[model samples]
Target: MPHIKVVGLGGSLKPGSASVLALKEALRGAEEAGAHIELFELHALDLPMFVPDRAPPESVQRFVDSVSTAAAMIWSSPVYHGSMSGAFKNALDWLELLSKHSPPYLTDKVIGLIATAGGVQGLQAINAMEFAVRSLRGYTHPLTAPLDRAWQLFDQSGQFSDEATLVRLRTLGKGVAEAAKKMAVLG
Candidate 1:
């Protein structure tokens, strides 16, 4: 089988945030599943707000290109006010550039959704992302990781302290890569 690429996008502006750490762990699972992985931390990307009529910036172009070429993706976001962070949403907005691609926005791509929250609203963010994935014409893995009380899951060093949750996140990643491979063969 040919190698597949999995792109990971999301994370809060705070460095080493729980959401980012979770994303890394999930990407590790994808790598173990024989897929190449690329991560786009929102803080590093510093993407500007989407302007419908304006040309995309270099960072936006790079992000869109990566998403366009990837066979699968893992999105991890921190829930803010019962939804995904604004920066994460803005990054998704940049995917509008992919509308001109031959297959268009996320077509044929499989996505895994993960959301971390201080309270119990992580699932809300995941639900919100599901709508976006559908709008982009992508398939989402049935296994999703909605990490509630994210602050307690990580240690002082930002590593996941809960083994079960960690395993769930990794399973989500592996599921996405495996699904993407099946889709590739079918398509």
Candidate 2:
């Protein structure tokens, strides 16, 4: 079976947030392209600020476990004030904890980054986030989905109706899906 684990980090807790919906769409497209996709909400994995002595919570472990086991992952978040949300950053904080000493937490997980913002330049935020993920030893997919004026991109059903937007999202999903499959097979 085509097994892929896709995690989407919603940058905000706002109801009907476009970030979450777009993430879901990416996951759906991945599945359609022959992947078993699971959407992980960063909001649900609440974590205390990363500290030296603090251990990971059960939920955080769950997230780390998913990353460790998945051959591929998709992390999408909306830009918050020109950067990724605190909640999303916090989740990565826990991931950082996995990298104590010379050990790596993300080892070789292939990742796809997505960002949604009110402006077309939201990919700037995605670029910043990609740097973080790469630092943890994760390989990032060059293909990205940075939605512009994302608030108006989706409808009430959380569906992206725009033609070009949908195409980009699908391309991202397919690319990640293929990468995940290859990563799993090679290793």
Best-matching candidate per TM-score: 1
In candidate 2, clashing pairs total: 0
Candidate 1 local lDDT, residue 85: 91
- Local distance difference test values of all predictions, in order: 0.92, 0.75
Q: Compared to the true structure, candidate 1 yields what TM-score? A: 0.98
Question: Would you estimate the TM-scores of all the predictions?
Answer: 0.98, 0.88
After superposing candidate 1 on the true structure, give the runs of residues whose Cα lies further than 4 Å from its correct spot: none
Q: State the lDDT of candidate 1 residue by residue for 11-120, as single tens digits.
A: 99997888999999999999989899999999999999999979888988888888888999999999999999998999998898988899999999999999999999
Compared with the true structure, the alpha-carbon lDDT of candidate 2 equals: 0.75
At residue 123, candidate 1 shows an lDDT of 97
User: What shift in Å separates residue 94 of candidate 2 from its native position after superposition?
Assistant: 0.7
Model 1 has an lDDT value of 0.92
Candidate 2 lDDT, 107-128, residue by residue in tens: 7777878888987778887888
